[model samples]
Target: MELTVGPNQFFWPAEKWSAFYRDLAEAPVDRVVLGELVCSKRLPFYQDCIPEALAALTEAGKEAVLTSLALVTLNRERKLTADLAAMGVTVEVNDLTALAHLPKGLGFHVGPLVNVYNEGTLAWLASLGAKRICLPPEMPLASVETLARAGAGLGVAIEVWGHGRLPLAISGRCYHARLHKRTKDNCQFACEDDPDGLEVRTLDGQPFMAMNGVQTLSDSYACADYQIEALAAVGVAALRLSPQSQGFFRLCQSYRERLNGTSPAGTIASEVLRRLPGTRLSDGFLTGPSGVSWSAAPAIP
Candidate 1:
């Protein structure tokens, strides 16, 4: 299976964002999805750098796609979506509204943020000219297997969330702004402070989730260390690695090696721990009882 790099979920400095894509151009990834997905306010800061990044990735022999916003509420956001196709690159639809804006018969991709729960939804998107789809992180292995089979029969490539923190939900309210006692409109770009997002703790002080602008993510990073073999065997097309603040380039290499069978399963998790010490790794949503559970053992037969 090929390795696809998902769009960056965190709000990094414009320079940092440019540098990340510059380095990623040579990384061992097959596809790179760029553009703003969480908040539209973050776009202008790095908008000028997108063309350069796309050119670099394309020149480096990678399929680069522009992603649509996860939630298109404002008029400006809708206008942005409408103009995405004119960029002359594939557009990954995170919101259904983006479909209406896309020119008919223009091939597009479906992002994980959209609810693609069953074969019916999958078929519908396929009929609408969706070329590929990155399944949501919360899907169970059974559901993934079924969808992969369906996608194959329909000639649509099926991808899974392979690495990085799981994006659980997105909302209109900016949680980061609320934490800083500001309204969403006048939030002052509070999310830029936490590049990987701010961890949310429960009443008992346990890290439960992460807050990033208007997006809520899982505190534990979702590592598909053990599911790689099973997913490949099931004819899954690709594995998506979401961008993080640190050690991401190396992490991409590790996943690439593991996918090519030059490295073993769970080895990526080891590198992740070395780079991000104390980070909780979980693949529970793939098979375990809950989203936060991690199985040290191999895939269950």
Candidate 2:
């Protein structure tokens, strides 16, 4: 199966953002989707670096696609969505508003944030010129199998969210600002302080969610270490790995090794845990009773 690196969701300094993509151009991934997928306000901070980054990825022999903002409400944001299609790169639609702006018959991609829960939606998107669709992270494996099968007939490649903090929701209001007693407009970009997003704890101090400006994410990182084979067996074409703040290039190599069958899934999972020590990992949304549940390593047959 092919591996794709999704857009960066955090608010990193311009240098850090540029370096991430520059490093990714050499990472062991097939395709790289770059551009601002979170708050549009963060775009200006690193927009200038995008062209060079895209060129680097292209020169390095990787398919580079630009991603639409997950929520486009402002006029400039709408214009940004409209202009992405003209950039001469594949546009990954994270919000449906982008569809209205894409030129007719122009093939595009769908990001995991969009609600692609059923085959009908998948087929409809394919009909509208979506060449590839990354099923939402919350989808169960059975639904994934059904869609993958349908996509096969329609000639559209099906992908799934293989890793990263699950993006649960996006809002017009910035939760990070609200947490700091500021309004969305003048919130001073407080979300940048926590590059990976601030951890939200429950009353009893249980980790619940992560706040990244307007986006709400699961505290536990969603992993597909155990489901790679099952998904490949189901005809899923690719796996998307969302860009995180740390060890991402190595993370790409790890997933690539697992996909190539050079490394066992258990070893990859253990390495991830060892490298990202305090983080919890889960694949329950794909094969469990809850999104936070982690299936134990399968016994060797």
Candidate maximizing lDDT? 1
Each prediction's TM-score versus the true structure: 0.97, 0.97
**In angstroms, how far off is 154's CA in candidate 1?**
0.9
- Candidate 1, after superposition: displacement of residue 126 in Å? 0.5
For all candidates in order, the CA lDDT equals 0.94, 0.92
Clashing pairs in 2: none
Candidate 1, after superposition: displacement of residue 261 in Å?
0.6
State the displacement of the C-alpha of residue 254, model 2, in Å, after optimal TM-score superposition. 0.7
Candidate 2 residue runs with Cα over 4 Å from true position:
297-301
> Please, what are the lDDT tens digits per residue for candidate 1 over residues 1-301?
9999999998999999999999999999999999999999999999999999999999999999999999999999999999999999999999999999999999999999999999999999999999999998899999999999999999899999998889989998999999999999999999999999999999999889998999999999899988899889888899999999889999999998998999988799888888778899999898898888887745569
Candidate 1 backbone collisions, by pair = none
